[model samples]
Target: MTTALVPPLAACAPVGVFDSGVGGLSVLLEIRCQLPAERLIYVADSGHAPYGDKPPAYVQARAEHILAQLRRAGCKAVVVACNTVTGLSIQALRERHPDWPIVAIEPAVKPAVALTRSGIVGVLATRNTVASPGLARLIAAHAAGVRVLPQACPGWVERVERGELDGPETEAAVAQQVRPLLAVGADVLVLGCTHYPFLRPVIERVAGPSVIVLDPAPAVARELARRLAQAGLAAPGPAPGDVAFWTSGDLAQTQRVIALLWGQAVQPQRLPDDPA
Candidate 1:
């Protein structure tokens, strides 16, 4: 009989996180808040900025590429912090890397259903994420009888990635996309994409005070913490862990956005398309 080998806890490396752009920083921020002693490696595949419109195969390929890079960088676990990518590629990733701890983001429909007073919840996400059968099943299982409105803000992610939060164009886009949901009496809105949290102010303004917007960052952070603890991979605390960032797009622009979002200077390393 063949014996299965076990990996030691010390061999489990830093947590790896990826997104199509800076939006994943929202999730990173949350993770840092919850697990201050755990090191993190974040990658922004900004060259492929909006994965929502891309084919499933393309998203999967990009995700696989990034995961390989993270593994090479000594990451023992990964988080698919983007909803579109998570929706399309997480299952395949888990299948391929069965030993690695993986956490993924999904729309907060269950929580929205639980919190809504009007029985109508709105989800603002990419077409790819909203259209996924996984999302449909989640709604069917956890939110039966509750009205779930999914709105795909096609250009919203692009605008947010460019650090354009509040302008005439952004305001107009937010208002246009949210009007129909509000019309249908949606009192709770889910910021379904990791990137969408950065646009919270605009979304709130468009949806009005009567509506509540929930960002899944806090929950994602909590889950990451739980997974690390369960796997005996949680880092001990005394000093804070280091955070390193990489991007496949313009390094300067990516650094600028990171600094803006993180409220500190960020010098992100630029990685090649095939960095091995």
Candidate 2:
């Protein structure tokens, strides 16, 4: 019989970040920028890319599985960097691990509501996030009487997953979703999905110079910093921490795209097969 060794949990343990795909790299970048001292462990569940279009139950299951893997890595805290999962599963996850420091992302609706000059804000997100009741509740809470248009960007996540940041087809797809919102006088566009940030230039070109695009990753990072301090899980440091990558997708392909998005080369390991 083989005994498995588990990493010891401590304030210095690496923070775990999970996303449906490379989109979560956007959030990871923010966390890295904000908390340079903390070691980071990131998982891109790319085999299940674009959780935005998946059913809530399916996304919830995948989220649970990935979180289990992160916990097994002995993460001090976990960040659900995928907005779709945050929308669909965050509450359940928090309930399941009440004492764990889990930070989740949501659309920047409150900020969009405040920033919209035309009182019309456009939210570009995954289908699942747009359809989730949590988004509706969020709009109701912060966007009262404001025209908060929820635009479900179907192909955006896949485009980013394939490392297609800019191209005619990508532009067309982004324009197809962005124009209508602009036509309707939405002066502020909120990137509700982490992957959407990679498409910001295209989105901005379609939206024109007058529009404001908001990414919530920076804010999420700040919130994470606060949470870690509150929980006394902040890493003590003078040295910059390193990042480890894992994926449940093709290792070579995942590594390539991650290098493209992350602006450097990184070798990503394949996730272990599910236990029997």
Candidate 3:
């Protein structure tokens, strides 16, 4: 009698990652690098791009739609890779899906406090993220005795979403945003929004070599790994896994953005605007 061979543990279903736009690609890239054996499914909700400026209720509704679609795709877990959504609606999502393993991003205030030699750290984030009470609580708890300066770049997210990495406009914007913080003796800058990392070069140019820039993607990935391991859902390693892309906006533009961000061509499948 012939026996059936079992598939390796690394070949499991993909983890789901979602963001308002292309910004989440930064987080997805980190997760892919850290957990190469695990597959990933990424959805860019570009139909509602730039969640940073949207109303809290609208952002929450969009998050719910995205999560439901991801759940239907058989995701092992979902990562709220956008800081705005994380700060605004993550608790609601957790309460609604208590058993689902969800990971959310927050500012790296704690880590920045630990690393800052000047005791002054600057945070560049969206309006929503900077104004969040969740972020306020985090600062109160972890950033004790550490001077924290928060700046909200009104159109920064939109510029990044449009694939504007470094240009005269971007450089000027960075300078305008970082100058005040630098003047106040900020030695470290926290990229509090996922999209902000894409403009790191501009920010670095403005802040100069004396300053250090921190992206929270790596820390977020580590937390994800810990949670997966604790839940006995970690993928066994050895081989690289596949990645599937989906978008709710222009597929061609989304594909280009994905390729630019990930260094790999992505042919994004279209999802219904009003997914039932």
Candidate 4:
């Protein structure tokens, strides 16, 4: 008796993608690159920014609300691009939408562990993501004998939201979180938060020439393509796809941030306020 999945929408119906903030653009870019035929509908839950520190219940509720909104918008599939929400609530999400082909993101720990030459892997994520039981299990299962270091990046998300990619303070923040891992022989640093990928230049600068900075967006994009194909949801290709954005934060601010992160100007649509 959970809500069953709705019938497949048109091939042209947009794919729904969401995150707590614009950080999801990293994932969106990959998806766009991989499946240029399918239009996208993205929502940034900026009003509740940084789900990383929120209680699980709060993040879960917001995730559910956004999913519901996307479904109502005739989306063919949905991508949960927020690691904090995915690690903590993916099962609940699947249970609620029994047949939806939802592609969720996770920290690139397995790949990082595999790519590490020094046997030490570092993961930088939000507080809640670092503490997530899912991440702990992932590390336990795949990181055998490897030293896995989890660092909670407190301000990276906010800085990205503010369009601060690299500056003195941003460089300092990246160095503060990364130097310890590099010093301890971590040759691979996984960008555990979607937001972190947007700050890759600073991360690379801080981690130096030897460390490999990894983001799971490409893998996520491939998986999404597979899911869409399996579900017969892939939009007809050859024709370029379009993007529509919605946010619960300041429209102008969100627009500016999305443009900076997304590499083009986008006119974001506003979501209707829910009285509930």
Candidate 5:
């Protein structure tokens, strides 16, 4: 159960953003940076964290639940900050809501292919995203003449949710995933999951400075700004905008971690459970 608040069209409505867990904070940061005047509401579905391993139907149902909440709140637009959700449901959702602008995050395979001096790139993501048909097509389209390795960092998302970013356990977790890619001569690593960006320092340490790490969050934010402008939904403000946070997990815990990850204090509201 994750939700967002949307104010009236004439009022200060916030853009909606949601992810399986706190991972989407990486995307939120970019959105805030690029669209400083626009308010944003972020949903962290931490009660059911790691949608990566869930079946397609289950994840879709959960996503639809969140989207429904946002739509009810009067969201002018939404950002699907979860790559797994993006790969699985973007088209279906677009068909369902033809008018609402939706922006999705995807693996930066094309750029990784272009940037790799070794002609080899690595993508670290959740299991579902790596196995997705959408990701497969992304590979088919852009990975030509380059080696693309997809590594599922099984516990990475949970680590970020728990705020375990750079200890020995975190180090071991990062090293375990990155070493294989490095050994395979992957010169550029595409952070296929939003959560992976927080582990960038450890990942850089493990992969060494020579390996370039790319996060797609900023691009998604820019795309959002473009789409908002196109739809004439961009918020009008010279004053700094406000942000709201909600989570399905423990309210206090969610607030603490969000404050940490968001680089400022945050007070998270409990996401009300959807009707059965």
Candidate 6:
């Protein structure tokens, strides 16, 4: 008989969240709103940011390393908050840690395909995610008879990382990729990358009122709640939970951007290149 990969932990154990960068904060906000009693520990692997352009092997390696870090931190479960990681490495992650209670996010293509009045859905994501086999299979499985356009927004993730959400440069970068999808009659847009949600206001303004934009963070949070409940891992009290953060990138810069995106000042701890 197979043994459980991780023995069940106390309900009060912190839930770990990680991403290539601060992009995961988008999902963290939703989880905080949904599970206020649960403590959270977030790690930003920003030294290797924009996993969208990396090879699957490289992305998988980084994911495994960070997950090990989270497990060592005594987390009850983990949330893979980066779509690139989710699209390319989720299957392997689960296989490696069966029964570890992992919750992963992916593009909301299924919902977008269902909701589109024009029968066309556009996805904005990183290059790797746009080309991932997982995403292709997702589209095939759920988007039958629908026109699904996957658009890779090259520099969009960097802009969000730098906290440039609404400047002229940011607007132009957004328009360059959005206008063509709109021209092709895509009435629904999916924010396939977590960082893209921080740029949602600009995208919505560019797409105008008729277009619908979807972000999967809320759905991810709900699924996390379900998984925790099923595992008997949900936090037990009503008090507001605390959060801690660590990053492999420049601490000052990450701190600044985290403050901007998270809507409060937070000092993120440093994640060592080689943790002991």
Task: Select the stronger candidate by TM-score from 1 and 3.
Answer: 1
What TM-score would every model get versus the actual structure? 0.94, 0.95, 0.93, 0.96, 0.95, 0.96
Top-lDDT candidate index? 6
Query: Model 2 reaches what TM-score against the true structure?
Result: 0.95
- Cα lDDT tens digits, model 1, 1-276, are 212223455434688999998999999999988888888999988878789999989889989899888877777678999998877877888888888788998899999999999999999999999988767877898898899988998898888778897888999989988999999899999998988888899899988898999998898899888887777777766578899998988888889888988879988997545542
Off by over 4 Å in 6: 1-9, 272-276
Question: Candidate 3, overall lDDT?
Answer: 0.85
Supply candidate 6's per-residue lDDT for 167: 81
Of 2 and 6, which scores higher on TM-score?
Answer: 6
Total clashing pairs in model 3 = 0
The sequence of per-residue lDDT tens digits that candidate 4 reaches over residues 208-274 is 8988999999999999999888877788778989899999888999999999888899998876563
Question: Which stretches of model 5 miss by more than 4 angstroms?
Answer: 1-12
In model 1, state the lDDT of residue 213. 97
CA lDDT, every model vs. true structure: 0.86, 0.89, 0.85, 0.89, 0.89, 0.91
Each candidate: RMSD to true structure? 2.5, 3.3, 4.7, 1.6, 3.2, 1.9
For model 6 the local lDDT of residue 188 reads: 99
Give the lDDT of residue 74 in candidate 3: 71
TM-score of 4: 0.96
How close to the true structure is residue 35 of candidate 4, measured as C-alpha lDDT? 92
Q: Encode model 2's per-residue lDDT on 213-233: one tens digit a residue.
A: 999999889989998887777
* TM-score (C-alpha) between model 6 and the true structure: 0.96
